[model samples]
Target chain A: MEQSFDDDEGVRWMLAWKAGDEAAFDRLVERYSPQVYALLTRFLGPRDNREDLVQEVFLRLLRNRDRYEPSARFSTFLYRIVFNLAVNHTQRVIQRAEGSLHGRHGDEDGEQLAELADDRASAPFESLEQDDVVRAVRSAIASLPENQRMALILAKYEELPYAEIAGVLGSSEKAVKSLIHRARETLRERLAPFLKEELA
Target chain B: MNLECAAFRRELQHSLENHAERSGAPLRDLLWHRHLHGCLDCRELLSAEEALEALLSSLPNPKLPPGLAQRVLARLSRPAGAQAELDALLELDRPESARPGLAGRVLAHLAEERALARRNPQPVRDLDVLLELARPVEIPVGLAERVKNRTRASTGTRGVLLRWRWMAAAALLALLLGVYAYYPRNPQPSPMVAMQDQPDPALLENLLLLEEWELLQGGDLEVLLSTLPAEDEYLLDLGAEGATEQGGQPKKG
Candidate 1:
């Protein structure tokens, strides 16, 4: 990935927005909306709830404009906010889906099993094989412990350096490396069948 | 290949994570190279890891919905008052004096305190009265008149009177110094001094009353009475006299 470097411009706009310039805020929103949208989409999966969440991320930026610390890169601060909100939205969606079923089914374990089965059965891919591969990968990513999942997203999707991801996640670079290492190992195991199919 | 499988796995994981580290390309450890050549399972793991990375990297970027920036800006087009409040909230790092409506906020806060004080009037009103009393006194009209009259009457003798006043002050100061010089530094109490130092019967009776009320325990009463200094005893005596002067009225009901 080509690592983009418009930080100086982005930071200039943020500082200007902090001083109550509306155009600066507009510029910032325009510049970062795509990244924010992409993060929310991946974090929340293919759900329609992401659009609102992306808007909320920007709204939060405006609402908290004055509190921005220029010493820190704006992207790190923005990702922290986006990650928090994304985690919250993801948890809410999971809870709502589970809550509705828990009332109907009355057996929590069975419902959880059913949910897992449904996740595999309902993957949106072109063919059965592709669906299995894609589903396995997505489910593996989703099932990761929140920190590992976020570490992978920030490193792989955002193309952030380990040090920068560490800053975003409030962890050491070594810790982030271990997180991504463990996460990738898990993904490799889950997708091994598909990899072998490709080899065959 | 003499590489332990576990060590090879660890190195492979490390290399994969650090492959594109800002410094340069990943390290190619000899053990990992030998293990991959010798072990089919390890080779399969590497291939799978590479495929997973490719799949992840190739995932489509989520397109921004049409008009998101416009929608966000539209939401931000709040009324001017709300915009100012938002600006104030965002600029909390700015100095309080630099924030808009600060004077208005301070005046509002003071007005709230004034209203609250009015509602709970007794303590605040008492404090206000105490402050008024403590303020410096202006010259009294009668005293002013008296001083002028006396000055006119004693004009010829004024210098002599002033000299006499200084002499009186000097004599009082000398007496005070003589008494201070004669005073014992750490006087041991004589029988007469002990008798004078003893608390009044009325005070002893009050301590006994407090004990009956269970307000003062026996040990506490002894500690309290034993630890009181002569100055505290004098003040207690004066306080008792003042209370008696008021016919021993209850200070609180």
Candidate 2:
């Protein structure tokens, strides 16, 4: 079950946690870990560092728990921490001295069709086509710039309102909207064949 | 595409996200309908966005690692009780009502005290009775004069003595008022008291608490400084005069 707390209830739990209610802390951890894990996986891709980064995110959450103000939704605060940690981790991985070993993954557009075919091994032709469409969409999303990718992820997957997404991004709502719009335009361009076929 | 169609396409996603029912005024809705009928690109864009949204919404939730929370809790080296105590103090370190339900409780306590005083014949004056007696109200024309006469008859004191006593009480009160109004109070407010604002009391409180807690202590500062974006790192370097050259660029020694 996808459990989520509204901002007020979340703040109450946060207050209780701050007041040393271990159960409240457990509730928060249980409630958000899956979502944070999913976000880290999607943003960082499947990497060895992803789990470590997720742990760092929670650790920072605990370390910086005092810095949280109930002014905005707790989710926004949590996501901002996630975004900063993910960005930092990405930068560090990029600059790692042994970076040559951890070469870039997910850059092969040529192999995308093959991957989709493999994913749909036993499926019918229609399912294969649908799977291809899904892969095409995911591929387009995975290829967006970091800021645009995150904005799209928060907007599309988390369904965060633009205002809250703006909070998470530390950008204005207009900027976030533009980011998503440009992201969608890029996705449309990348997936144009699948989109045209699907629409037809 | 015409400018109108372009404008419609640009706003189509926003509108669809907000107004799924296509709710608008008649003329506006007509324009939207006309635009959709005429502009194939807009229709396709809308369809594609919706299809992608559907696909994204259907993506399966990832399975979390088993025993994740226990793993996290185990990473916390500090004892839970100590952390809990500190957290409790932090929680209590907030602004609260000045006199939350205090008046009633004080009154009840005072009543109990008065009952005890009555049983023991103690000299403790009940403030409630004093307040009732001192409360302002209309009185007979010569009420003060009657009081003075009664006091003089009972204690055989002159009006001059009563006047001097009244003058002394007034002077004492004025002196006390002057002292209270002019004396230098504590110049510094507590950190928590220093950071009170309307909406987010916790924001400033947490900022000060973080500073006081020494979040950047030990090598954590280095880790944090390393995480600063390039621009911030540059500014930090420039401000600290740690940069060997001007404009945050390095100079070879």
Candidate 3:
């Protein structure tokens, strides 16, 4: 099937599916799968189970196909779903780790093990040097407070306009700009040695 | 550089990130102009920051494994049986547009019947006995068979009573409505009636004249009494005694 770039293809496919055409649904899956996969991979990275997460995203898409309204840009709607699920999964993992630690009677040493688990789970990007740098940057990003990290991710990776970023994060454009500025300041500080070499 | 002027360089860093390109001149020109004026450290720092931004932007995005798309597609493809079930369910819920004309005609007929029934009116029968019987009656095996006979027997009486009661109710309502419509009501006064109720000009002038006469009499009496000389008072006393002797009436001068 030939993919369309008309931007309304998602809406067209949805309407056609509602009208009982199966082929249009197939086309929809083909068109949006890669975009959804790309976003999930960015969120989960290489080492964390990408396939399960991607499959989970698509399964949710199937379950929620009826709710897919065409008012927003399809990519925005799709990525919003992916982002929410990924954040939820991350939160669950964090909660599980906390539970384990609490059950073990205040083992401070478990903190290192948890960090190691995180490092190992996020290890696939370590192969390429640039990937390694991006990973480092991502880790630094993940270390940021949730609001700032969300603001940065939507602005940088999603290439969303400040207004759109504001909409996603439930903030104003000025606040979004402030968040990105603060994020960049933090990133610059962390990557100063690397940045200095790059500049040289 | 003075700290006050150096503070602008901090703002310049933020501005450079937010506004990457200078509006008119090349960024280098703007930077060099600022540099020439003062603040060598900031000039160097700005240049370094710009160089780093360029390098970061030039880095290529990493390509994913080739199987990524295939893997995603494979996961999304539902099994044939599941797909068929979903299709069937969707079909069941699909909005039906057939027979609208026939349905509309039937609805119109029912609505017309209802309107006619309302206009002709209906009687209220005493169903209390029937209701009491219904409440206590146990359904026997032969009850259904007796229902048809009972219905036929009651139909004539029901019809006559319903019609008579309807007519009586309508007549009573009409009488009440007529009384409400034609009964005498208190007449509200208009602006013209209020104008007519006001005092007449002749009456108002007479009242004013009476008030002025009383005031004049009071004032004149006070002035005459006040201006009388002491000898005149004694003469008045003598006149009083003389008047008493002469049948108690003073003669007018």
Candidate 4:
């Protein structure tokens, strides 16, 4: 179950922002933008327009500010906004990326797929021995099935519990656990070489 | 494979549920220390888990553009800046009717409307309601007729269907209650608000919740979740950059 946020810092600040304290909203922007930036970077890949996307997230918050009553956690509401934005944005971007590629390489469909793969490419895994465990792990995570990848990232990095991850991902807790389990399994297999030896 | 291994895995389950494990918790659990002695794969799993945690902590953060918060706040304050940016964002077929000038444009229009309203105040002729005089009130899109027909036609399966409709209404009401519990300030909004009630975005979100809850009443949600595309293979082409630093990575939400 999700925790209550009736008195959460973000909620209080947002309520104050609703009460005409523009500085309160600024406090929220300062405090939460890093996390938002990180998630957008993760979800959208490293693109030039990322800061714009981050701005869009807050812009969405600003636009929908009145809709936000103090009922739910401000972070949860913000996350829902970002997650939906990212999904829709990713869908649009990838479609555009593919369309541009298809247009450019009208003849060579095979090469188009390969170049698209590298739109947000991982470093070559050919030299895993030289690559640090972190690089190996990032590539492995980048390669995961979408559901598993999101569940793991939210669970492991963002410090959200399985239930909240489920809430964010529109899945039940069991499904979230299944997703994480599948993610861990894949990570274990992919990073097996790096994971084999115990840490010093 | 053995009982101790199963037990070791049981103790390990809480690792994901808690954050302390990610911050690099020491191997203090005697059960963890004890079980690893007998199992090879379990020991490997333990090593992998620890290594993953370490790598995660050491992962680089994406470099932020100079003054990101400032940029966003500037846009918030400056309607002109926001208008140009929002026009670009409008390219994405976002569900909201965020047309080109959504932010600055809306504000400008509202300001204009305010000015207009002040300039032209319509004379108010208060209707005599206490006279109980019937005015030609337009029926609200046949809702009263539909309710009248439904009440008149409630019989057998029709009554059951009506009951199901009420149940769905109650379910929707409960979902609303869950998202927006007692509105403390204005528990009941004005009739104007009630007239303009639109579907809650949160209500749409919790539909998934209510669906899962209903399905799981006698079945597993995992089974249902299994059907949700684990990966849109076409979309996974976008790749995830959540973990990577600037410049290169796959993008997927």
Best by TM-score: 4
Ranking by lDDT: 1, 4, 2, 3
Q: Rate the local accuracy (lDDT) of all candidates.
A: 0.64, 0.60, 0.56, 0.62
Off by over 4 Å in 3: A1-8, A102-135, B1-62, B89-253
Going through the candidates in order, their DockQ values are 0.19, 0.07, 0.13, 0.22
Interface RMSD of each: 5.9, 11.0, 11.5, 4.3
Score candidate 1 by lDDT: 0.64
DockQ-superior candidate, 1 or 3:
1
- Local lDDT at B9 for model 2: 61
Tell me the docking grade of candidate 2.
incorrect
lDDT of 2 by residue, A71-128 (tens): 6778888899898877765554444323333663443322433433332232223444
TM-score of 4: 0.56
Estimated TM-score per prediction? 0.52, 0.48, 0.48, 0.56
RMSD, each candidate, Å? 27.6, 41.0, 24.4, 40.5
lDDT of 3 by residue, A1-200 (tens): 55443567777786666455657756766777666665655554444355555555555555455445565555655666677776766665565566666675344236534543553243323423564655555555556655676676665555677766676666788898889878777767766656666667
Task: Give the C-alpha miss distance for residue B187 in model 1, angstroms.
Answer: 61
Q: Candidate 1 on B1-253: residue-level lDDT in tens?
A: 3457677777667666554553443223354676677788877776676677766765667777888777655644445675467556656655756866443333333333443354336784446423422324797779988988777766757656775888888999999999999998997888866756776668667865765576854345445655555455564564444444445631211
Off by over 4 Å in 2: A1-7, A47-49, A97-135, B1-11, B16-35, B54-58, B77-253
Q: In CAPRI terms, where does candidate 4 land?
A: incorrect
* Strongest candidate by lDDT: 1
Give the number of the best model, judged by DockQ. Answer: 4
Ranking by DockQ: 4, 1, 3, 2
> How good is the docking of model 4, as DockQ?
0.22
Which scores higher on lDDT, 2 or 3? 2
